[model samples]
Target: MNAIEIINISKTYKSKTKTITALNNISLEIKEGELFGLIGPDGAGKSSLFRILATVLLPDVGSAKILNYDVIKNFKNIRKLIGYMPGRFSLYQDLSVEENLKFFATIFETTIEENYDLISDIYKQIEPFKNRRAGKLSGGMKQKLALSCALIHKPKILLLDEPTTGVDPVSRKEFWEILKKLKSQGITILVSTPYMDEANLCDRIALIQNGKILDVDLPENIVNKFDKDIFSVASDNMFLLLNDLRNYSHTLSCFAFGDSHHLVIERNKADENLLIQYLSRHKNLSVKKIEPTIEDCFMQMLQSEN
Candidate 1:
């Protein structure tokens, strides 16, 4: 069964001088017990779409349903069935860690003990600082606390918006581990993130940009769909090398990836020797055929769109 359904949903923000579309005819379905990811960079309308699903914001057009409850007409029922952790920390800063969790439980008419098993692994990490004010905890600790509160009611679906953003790498890893456990227990998860590497961790992902979904598929499938031959080129002068590669006659697309540049040329048109001789003037030059990654696919999609 599908846990969430969004059909032709659209949202826009207007000010005196500008009108910005946050979502443009978006439609998607997330299956029950699936860990789905909404992948995109900042200002890509991830938050706006999430807000609509969480029933916190109404869509300007179309409609959404969570667990079969219409977001507009059945918000109260929908709210009771989902756990939402917004991109920002929304818990009470003045409340102590325990207080915040208990407060949320109270609002849902449930006790932490009743759902203790659901949040036990996460709560234990923050229990030591239970008496500490929420504002006094570190970023990672704050994240754990917020998650614990979100799960306090044992909601069937979890909507986590950039939950790992601004968190330390170690904490991010730990948090994803927690998510895996939650998925094993049959909680449907829809997580949004700008981190391309994290896309692989999801069961399926939707890549979004400028309020539009570029593609949706398994990470490996998306990478495999990249049809062009790409080579990773590196030289002593990285900046100059990038400009030269982009200007090369056979170059189709070239983008800097870490210390090297990934260059895509007209398929099967350039040999290693030809590329080497062309770049012979550069010192420490190296070029090797490489497979495309999720980020590479995303860049290629964006380039094609333009």
Candidate 2:
């Protein structure tokens, strides 16, 4: 069964000076128990779409359904069946971790004891500090506590918006592990993140930008769509190398990635030898072929639109 359905949804925000379209004719289907990702940068409508599905914000046009309940009319029912964790931590900072969990459980007319098994693994990590005030906890601990409360209700669907942003690498890894465990328990997850590397963690992903979806497919499938041969190039002078590469006639695109620049070349016009000879004018330049990643695909998509 489809856990969520969005049909031609569009949302716009108005200010005294102008209007901004946050979502543009967006439509998608998320299968039951699937870990689906919405990949996009900030101001790219990821949050807007999540809010609409959570029934906390209304779209200016179109509609959406969560677990077959209409977001507009059956909001109360939808709320009862889903656990939403917004991009920002919204828990009570002054309350103790245990108190916060108890409060959310009560709001759902449920108790932590009733859903202990669902969140036990996560909750236990923070249980030692259960009496500590939420504001006093570390970023990672706060994340665990928030997730525990979300699962305390044992909802069928989980909507997490950038749950790992600003978190340490260890915490980010641990968080995804928790998500995988939850998926095993048959909970549908719709997570959004700006990190391209995280896109591979989901069963499928939708790439969004400027309030529009560029593509939706499995991570590998999306990477396979990149038409150009890519290479990693580096030289003693990085900044000049980037500028020179952009001026190269055979260069389809070049962007800095880590210590090297990722150069996508027109397949018909360039090869390793040609790239080497072309950059030989600069001393100590080195180039090597590299596999394209999801980030490469996203950049290609953005380039096409421009």
Candidate 3:
């Protein structure tokens, strides 16, 4: 059975006279035991969709199901079988690390000891400081505590919304490791994040933009779909280099990618010898063709979809 299913789900919020559509006609199916990811930038509606699936908010239209439980009608049952970690840490500030975990377990009518093994790997990081107030913990430590509490009940599905947004790089890697471990336990997982690098970590992902689904597939597959010869160029004069590339008749699209700029050939235009000599004569820069990455493919897809 599909772990989660959503059909043409759309959510809109009204403020004064303006109506903002947070989620469009979004439709997706997540298989049981799969680690599915929702990837997009802020205001792309990743959190809105997560909240709807977690039964925290209702869609303006459409239907959704989590493990065959209706998100709208079976709200109580759905809430019991799902573990939700929002983008922000919402644990009790005055409570200690151990106290917070115990409080969550009690809400689910369970004890921390009963499900200690489920959170042992994560809990161990903060267990030594269990008596410390949760508000006093570092960002990484707080993340661990929130995740530990989420798993205390051993829910059937896990929903994480930008769980690694502000955490350190080391902590982000550690968090993904925890998700992999949880996936091995057969708990279907759905995580959403604005970070492009995190998209590849998932088994599959749906790239969203402006409340719309652009493409849904494995990260490698999406990159493989990119058509056209792409190249990368870097120079000390970044601004001048971009302008020179744009003036070239053969350049299709040129955008900065970190220290280098990525370029696409202008339709059927492929001439390395002539292009190099042209840029040398014009921008006095070094350039070479390079492979496309997920971000490159995303740009292509976005432009095409638009």
Clashes of each: 0, 0, 0
Model 1 lDDT tens row, 1-306: 789999999999999999999999999999999999999999999999999999999899999988889999999999999999999978899999999999999999999889999999999999999999999999999999999988999999999999999999999999999999999999999999999999999999999999999999999999988888899999999999999898888899999998899998766887888888888889999899998899999999999989
Candidate closer to the true structure by TM-score (higher is better), 1 or 3: 1
CA lDDT, every model vs. true structure: 0.94, 0.93, 0.89
* Candidate numbers sorted by lDDT from highest down: 1, 2, 3
Q: Give lDDT tens digits, candidate 2, residues 189-288.
A: 9999999999999999999999999999999999887878898999999998999999988888899999999998876567688767878877788888
- Candidate 1: Cα lDDT at 21: 97
Output the worst ten-in-a-row residue range by lDDT, candidate 2. Answer: 266-275
Query: Residue 203 lDDT in model 1?
Result: 98
Q: lDDT tens string, model 3, 222-247?
A: 88777788888877788888888887
Clashing pairs in 2: none
Where model 2 places Cα greater than 4 Å from the true spot, the runs are none
Using lDDT as the measure, the top candidate is 1
* Model 3 stretches with alpha carbons more than 4 Å out: 266-268, 281-284
